[model samples]
Target chain A: MNLILLSPNDLLTDNRACIKNPRQLAHIKQVHGATVGDQLKVGLINGNLGIGLVTELNDTAIYLDVDLHQAPPRALPLTLVLGLPRPKMMRRILQTVATLGVKQLHLINSYRVEKSYWQTPFLEAENIREQLILGLEQGCDTHLPEVHLHKRFKPFVEDELPAIVADTRALVAHPYTETACPCQIEYSLTLAVGPEGGFIPYEIDLLEKCNFEAVQVGERIMRVETAVPYLLGRLF
Target chain B: MNLILLSPNDLLTDNRACIKNPRQLAHIKQVHGATVGDQLKVGLINGNLGIGLVTELNDTAIYLDVDLHQAPPRALPLTLVLGLPRPKMMRRILQTVATLGVKQLHLINSYRVEKSYWQTPFLEAENIREQLILGLEQGCDTHLPEVHLHKRFKPFVEDELPAIVADTRALVAHPYTETACPCQIEYSLTLAVGPEGGFIPYEIDLLEKCNFEAVQVGERIMRVETAVPYLLGRLF
Candidate 1:
């Protein structure tokens, strides 16, 4: 973990907190090999970046004298509208989105998205939060990305996506598109990426009607996990 | 599998081939749902991209009338020098490197790289080829990336890295560096990325002596897997 993320529950006072989670405890002890009096990079969730002075180091808990000041890394000026991926892939994508500093993510249905994917327990609020927290820890950030799910494709695209695309550079990643994906864009963007086989023609048409221009990266097809970082890196 | 990749052994004649591998057979039958007379995208290993007309299909094999004429997707003009990742992560990174169209990859040792990483069976030629094939299939490309292993760091940087970075834009991903990574560069590049905790100062100094300019992506620290693609996307 790059940063020791603190939740309100861990607080003993405004300036003090304790880390008791076994996973975090194990990481701090084993990976970091930290000890009492050693200062660690830390941040409060949805708050500011700072340091935690290790006041007490024990097997059960690591008490920190907290100090908060600096802001987290800048959030990407982009909204990701992704086709709900397969259950196995969804877990990593959640972490990736947050790690890349994307603040807004919408998991929407698409023709190529399997119905079974929507049924995965990984979509549970607590499970989703766990993955995002891992991402936040890896990225060393404080603000969490907001994830919204849309089970229905039509209503989401027709009624909701328009406003999301209103002032942004709306884009949909499609292999068949003649236009190459733009690079190093300065404006905010709403990027839609499809499922494995890609969004069907009718689905593309629906997205196009919402003012989303289809763009292709290259001839090579990349999996969603790779594409997410690839697109973000290229655009930003 | 996006493309049925054929090795020389699979070719029965100049115009015909048979896929006897159970994995390929299952994917063709189940995923592609191909039958006699069905044409599927196919590519010769390290050769051209074309179509294969299914002429015979059975439990044991699928025969194809192969016709290769078109060239594969353009290869990225990059030579990746990466610190050998953890074994589990190595498998995925190999596939990702090929999928992204990098043709030359050198997995070198770094201060942070665990000694056990170089001992992974996944580094074996046949096993590495298997992963690269899966990547080519996923990417719909024909050319397989060449992977080289460097068990020693100092020698590789002093003896080999200089020549590799001679003409190309040489960059090392260092979080401590002040220069932001450049994007949309229309030139060949040689990029060096470190393992999990990153290369030590002494290692970075050696790289700098070899004319490698260190650059940072942003504030957030990405995992090696994420950083590989992120660096490639930004640089190219």
Candidate 2:
């Protein structure tokens, strides 16, 4: 963990805290290799960044006293609309978009998306939250990105997407499109990416109606997971 | 697996090829859901894309008759020089660069790289090849990228970088730098990325001596793996 993330409720009386969780303890010992008196970068989950001093340590647990002052890390002014990828690729996409600090993510269904993918265990709310937390820890951030799921494309586009694109610049990544994806983006952007085979023509039309401009990265196609980081890099 | 990748040696024999490996079988069953008479996209390792007909399937094995006539996917005119990242991130980086069809990848030592990272199991030749195949399968491409390791930064910069940079547009990504990464690259380009904490000033200077121009993607500091796809997106 690049930053040790703690929740506000974790603090105990007298500003002391004890962590007995196997996951957190393993991180402290195996990842950080922390010892007593070692000050580590810490952040309150959804709160603030701070420093934590390892006041006590043992095989099963560790204790820390924190001094929180800095504000939460600023999120990128970008929202990603992804056609839910395969379960494995979805894991990487969730962690990556969270690390980059995207303000929101919409996992929408497209024609190319398999219906069974919606039932993958990785899409469970708890699992999604865990992946986001991992990304935040890696990026030294505290705030979590809001994730929304949409199963129907038409209702989402005709009802929800208009408002979503109202004040933001919307761009869709389609491999065979005419417009080239822009390089330097100085304003907030909403980027939409398709499933493994990409958005069908009708889907692209629907996105265009919602004000998303179709763009291409290059002639060579990329997987949905790779495209997420690539789009974030360009837009952010 | 988007495409089944086969080695050239696998094609010397004529009628039938048997694939009993768990990984390949699982991919065929789970990802492709292949059945008898199913024609799938197949690419010969270091060769061409072709059609594969699933001739038979049993409890432990799959048989296919492949036609290898189409040419291999074209590679992007890009070379990547990355400050060796942590091994976990390195695996993603290697797979990503290969998926994006980069011609070369250089993993160089930098100040922030942990010494122990060099010993990661993912760096083993077999493991690296596995990741490359994953990427090739994702992109429907067959050519493998050439990977180079440079432990001594100074010697590599002084001795080899000059010829490497000759007649190519070389750009290095460092956040907070002056120039913004350019869009619409139409020629062969080389992109350099740093480790987690980024390259020290001395290392950047040595790169400058080797005619590498420093560029920034944006003000946001991105992780190395994220930066790879982002850089490739902007450049290619």
Candidate 3:
């Protein structure tokens, strides 16, 4: 963890806190290489950024006294609508979107999405939360982005997408599209990307009808995970 | 696996071949969900792409009758110089750089890089090769990018960097720099990124002395892994 994250509830009780969990301890010792009295940057989960002074250290645990007063990170004005990628790629996507501090994420089903992928262990609530937390820590931010899943395409397009696109600039990424994805977009954008094979004609029509202008990254098609960072870089 | 990669020797043999290794079998069954008579895209390692017809299936393995007769993937006209990231991020970086098909990679040492990171098991030859293979499989290409390691910064910068930058455009990504990273460059380019906290002023100076121009992605600093794809997307 680049920044040790503590929840607001944890900070309310006392200024002194002891970290005994194996994962956090390993991170403190191995990743941070913390020595006694080393002041480390810390953030409250959904709270503020501050410095945590290490008071005591051992092989298994460490103690810290935190001082938090800084404001939470500003949320990105982007909402990502992604076609559910393969399990491995999805994990990377989740982390990248979180690190970029996107305001909302919609994981939607598409023509190319494998039915089996939804069952992967990586989609479990706890697993998803852990990945988001890691992304937040790496970016030295605290607020977590909300994640939504859409298992049916028709319902999402016909029933839900209009409201989501109502007040936002919506863009969909397709390899064969003519317009290039813009850089430093001024308005809040809702960006949609397809699965590995990409959105079919019908899917594209649905999105276009909903006011999503089609955009292309390059002539070569990139994997969904790679495309997420690429799209974010261009838009942000 | 998007494509089943094979060796030249495997292609030279007759059409019918049985793949029985634990890894390949597990990948076929668990990842690809291949069955008898399935038509799958296959590629010759460092060579051509073709279609494979799965002719037989047994308890332990699957047999494919291959027809190899297609051109290799287009090469990316880019080289990456990255300060070594942590082990977990390193795995993603290896796969991502390989997937993007960069011509070469240089993992250099920097001030913020912990000394112990050099000792990671993921740096082992076998492990690195495995990640490269995974990247190739995901990208549907079989050519592996060459990876280089530079442990001592000063000597590498003074001795090796000049030669490397002789014929290629070199750009270093530092967040505080004034120049925006150029987009749509027509010629080959080399990208340099720093460790977590970024390159110290002295390190940036050495790179600048070597004809490396410093550039920034945006106002926000991105993690090394995220920056790789971001940089490539804009430059290439």
Candidate 4:
């Protein structure tokens, strides 16, 4: 972990926190190879970003004198509405989105999305939180992304999506579009990316009515994971 | 697989190919749901972009009446010199690079690169080729990226790198650099990306001596895989 992310539950005093979890403890010992008095990058969940001086480092736990002062890095002014990827791809996408500083993510169903993907246990609240934590640690940020799952496409887009796209520049990454995606855009944006084979003609029509302008990345088709970072990097 | 990539061995005649491998056969049946007379996108390894019409589909194999016509997508006018990623990340990087149309890649050693990463079986020729094939299928491109390995750093930089960077825009992704990475460069470019923890000062100095300008991506840190596509998207 690049940053040692702490929870409110880990707080022991006004400026002290104890990490009892094996995951962070083992990482501190093995990956960081940390010793006492080392000022490690530490951040509180949804709080501040600062440093934690390692006071006690043991195999079981580590105690830190926490001092959070600076604000976390700015979150991307974007909301990602992505088609639910297959089980294996889902884990990495969650982490990638979080690391890319996405504050809001909506994983919705599409025509090509497998039915069994929704059945995946990896979509559990705890599992999603765990991966997002890992991503936050990687990106050295504190804000946790709020993930919303939509099992039905039509209802979510027809009922809920318009509001999300109301004030933002709504976009969908479509291969066949004549409009190329704009770059270095700083305004609020809501980007919709689809599953492999992309959204069907009818689904694109629905999204168009919702005010999402289809933009092509390039002639070369990219996998969802690759496309996400590519599009994010270009847009902001 | 988006495009069914065919090997020379799969060719039965001038305009015919048979896919007997369970991997492609299963994908054809399950993913494409192919039937006789259905034409699917197909590409020949290191050859042409074309189409294959299914003439026979059964339990063991799927025979295709092939028609080779169109040229493959243009290859990126770039040479990527990257620090050897961790074994698990290595597989995905190879695939991502190839899918993005990179035809030249050099995996080299750096001070931060773990010594054991040089010993991974995934670096073996056959294994690397497999991932490249999968990438070509996803990209709908025919050319495979040529990968070169450098076990030692100083020699590779001093002896070989100058010639490779001679006629190209040479850049190294350094976090501490004052130069920001350029965008949409149509010229040939050589980009060097470091492993996690990044290249040490000594290594960066040597690279500078080899004519590589140090350019920064941004303030936020990204994993090598995410950074690869992100950088490629911006440069192209």
Estimate TM-scores for all models: 0.99, 0.80, 0.80, 0.97
lDDT of 3 by residue, A1-236 (tens): 56777755545345766777577788889878899889988877788788889989998767789888788667878888989889977677787788778859999999999999888998888888888878887777888878898999979988999999888999999877789888766788899999988999999999999999999865445678788887777676
**lDDT tens digits by residue: candidate 4, A77-101:** 9999999988998888898898889
Candidate 3's TM-score on the B chain: 0.94
Q: Which parts of model 4 have CA positions greater than 4 angstroms off?
A: B58-60
Q: Going through the candidates in order, what is chain B's TM-score?
A: 0.98, 0.94, 0.94, 0.98
* Stronger candidate by TM-score (2 vs 4): 4
lDDT of 2 by residue, A64-102 (tens): 988888887678878889998998787878888888788
- Stretches of candidate 3 off by over 4 Å are A11-38, A44-74, A85-92, A111-130, A176-179, A196-201, A219-221, B13-39, B50-73, B112-127, B218-221
lDDT of each: 0.92, 0.82, 0.82, 0.91
Per-residue alpha-carbon lDDT of model 4 for B56-111, expressed as tens digits?
Answer: 99999999999989899899999999999999898899999989999999999999
User: lDDT (0-100) at residue B162 of candidate 2?
Assistant: 82
Q: Residue A226 lDDT in model 3?
A: 84
DockQ of each: 0.83, 0.40, 0.29, 0.70
lDDT of 2 by residue, B1-236 (tens): 77888765556365346777678888898878899999878877887788888988887978889887888767888778888889778777777888889868888888888889888888888888899888888777899998888887889889988888888988888875899788767888877888988899998998888888899865445677777887776666
Question: What tens digits encode model 1's per-residue C-alpha lDDT throughout A1-236?
Answer: 89988988998988999999898999999988999999999999999999999999987999999998899999999999999999998878999888899999999998889899999999999999889989999999989999999999999999898889888989999999899899988899999999888899999999998988999888888998998899889999
Displacement of residue A72 (Cα, Å) in model 2 is 4.1
- Docking level for model 1: high
Q: What share of the true interface contacts does each candidate keep?
A: 0.71, 0.46, 0.23, 0.58
Instruction: Looking at model 4 chain A, report the run of 10 residues with the lowest lDDT sum.
Output: A216-225
| Superposition error at B149 for model 4 (Å) | 0.7
Model 1 ranges with Cα > 4 A deviation: none
